[model samples]
Target: MDIKNIRQEMALLDDVIPLEGHHYAACLQTYEAASSQRKLILEWFTNHVIPQIPRDSASFLSIGCGAGELDVKILAAAKEQASTIAYVGLEPDSKQCERFTASMALPSDQNIRVETLNTNFEKYTEQRRFDRVLMVHSLYYMNDPERAIEKALNLVNESGKLIILIASNDTLNELSSSFWQMENGGSTWFSEDLSKHLDKRGVAFDRHRIKAKLDITSCCAPESEQGIRIADFIAQAPTGELPPGLRTMIFSYLEATSHLDGEMRWLPHNVDAFII
Candidate 1:
């Protein structure tokens, strides 16, 4: 249960896995469940967050903006109200950046400018701040989450805000705690832990819960390609190269806990959003 050794395990996973498209197919199975629950986060952002930005031209920075899908949605929604937005993305993967740039080319009546920096947030610097800064589901992999949060907060202009989305510690992360803790004595990563660090720093923030779940029945299918990807994602392993015993344990865990909601076999998620 040595905390220092946890990073080594994380690094091993990072070095071994390229996460591109690993969750895409699995996501397709849970689309209905995901869409219904995730809409709340989007609605909150549009109603509460979008109003914070200036109606004129505004700049946005999204760390780990994979393929710019959410950015596009935000931009399109902003357009409905006649706001101009310029997007800057920071993503380490070149292929993802390329996809982000390509997807943003859609013809739109709204004023928009798109740019992607193929770099990690730790090394990125800007002369000026942005109207909005987002770190969605990206902080878990950071070597230093507190520092990353601080850096993102600094990038927000005087009137802008830094928004972060992470999983609540009491929920799914708790279910999958054995793998993440590995030999670590306690939970090291999760929204609850992040909130504590922020609180210790006397940082003021607002919190909201976004209820969501994934139907992973397909993961249990015969030959289970989706199941394999689910395991890879949970383990953060590139090839899902888990020990036979560990794989069996994880599969048993998933099967036992999967909730049946009518026709859906749901794996519930408790996601939280922090606005600072």
Candidate 2:
């Protein structure tokens, strides 16, 4: 990673403008289509974790379950063992919450009782503990990840488990960290940091490495709308709106990090699953 180069470029910028509204949504869609985030998580949760799922309560507590797309799949994974799934999602984004509520209304999710709270994990006031808890790809948004993890764990019943999906010094996150700092004024945490925190707290956990990738050929196309959108998603910022030097630097870093295999540009999208 060209951390120094990105830092140099970011220093030339006033601030990072985070992509929001429809543009962000579009970029996310492109990223999702190219990445295997949902499939990897769903398969791992079903094959490796679901068999050991405690049957105390068919209830599931998902922290930062965005838009309910993955939540529906997760609940489905537990369906073979439990007739119905009680799903409660915690997300601070109201727009996403609305989408979640709408998506959960589909007949396919009829067996799951879905409840969404447009609030952060730290602000959830539910006193009821859940039999299973999940915090997939959502921990990076936490102001205090340790507190949030402890809170999520506290919400899990004795026989239940807490599954936290995060990245292990995820390469793409390194490319985005500089922009994130500019946007949030602080550094973000990764799986290694979380593991160290758990170890320091004497919380034993099993870490599983899940491999995935993305076809980032579109991201390499500097002028195309789809390319810009994917690049924006990668940097978590408006790549086109960025300072010229920083924008070029970031794309250079991305291109350098990505490897070419025939006609496809494969960008590593690996993640780590921490099961406690």
Candidate 3:
């Protein structure tokens, strides 16, 4: 279950499912019960990160900017703080790029402008740097995560920063690991590993933990539509039908690690924040 093996399996999954669609959206909705990850990140950005940057005009580049929610949030915060901002988003899906473009439509009076490119980061050779380069929840999907990290770091200006947000291995790792193990898949990448990648490359960074939770109560039911959907969502590698034994094992592992409160089964979210 090394990095190389996990990456090969992830590439295979990506070939099957392009990482965007109805099931993916549904999975995101289900995970909304544990929203503290984004909240804490946003809080830190506004209160701590933004203030530390002395520049009044900031540039941001987002790789795999899904739905452009983070871009919108960043722009809104910048406007409130009287900071002029320029944002560029890179996404492979045309539909998602369209959404990212639409989400960036700021009012005439606002001090923010957005541009989007419909392409994956690996193929994008545009040479430009920005004040803030974002890789939120997108690094793991890269074809070469190390290369991508290096490219992103190279794109950061002297006064700029590379902000990365990823799920810690401690949270939801068992379910994904078990799913891959059943299929002879390898280990997946997490924030902890990403930090190691940075360290290996001699990149300096600051790490922070964001406390949150994940609700997997419905995933306990293997046969139901919700259960299957949850499995597909978290595994991100749903092929045809999952064997019953694998599903049972996944649910049992989830149940074992989960804490039940009323109708909600809460699993602690280990969200790690990296700033370079």
Best by lDDT: 2
In the range 30-127, model 2's lDDT, one tens digit per residue, is 88887876688789888887777655448888888878888877766677778667888888888888988887674765666888899977788788
Q: Give stretches of model 1 more than 4 Å off.
A: 1-38, 108-110, 174-188, 238-240
Task: Tell me the spans in candidate 3 whose CA falls farther than 4 Å from its real position.
Answer: 1-20, 177-186, 221-228
Q: How accurate is candidate 2 locally (lDDT)?
A: 0.81
Q: Best TM-score goes to which candidate?
A: 2
lDDT of 3 at 232: 67
Ordered list by lDDT, greatest first: 2, 3, 1
lDDT of 3 by residue, 1-276 (tens): 233343344344323332247566666555553445667677867875666654578888989897787678877776665467778998887877888888888668556778899998989888788888988888767756778888998898988899888888774665564444444434557887898888887878899888877667777754656655655666664523444444354456567767898988778876787889
Better of 2 and 3 by TM-score: 2
Weakest ten-residue segment in model 1 by summed lDDT: 25-34
For candidate 1, give the lDDT: 0.68
State the TM-score for model 3. 0.83
TM-score of each: 0.82, 0.93, 0.83
Candidate 1 C-alpha error for residue 31, in Å: 8.8
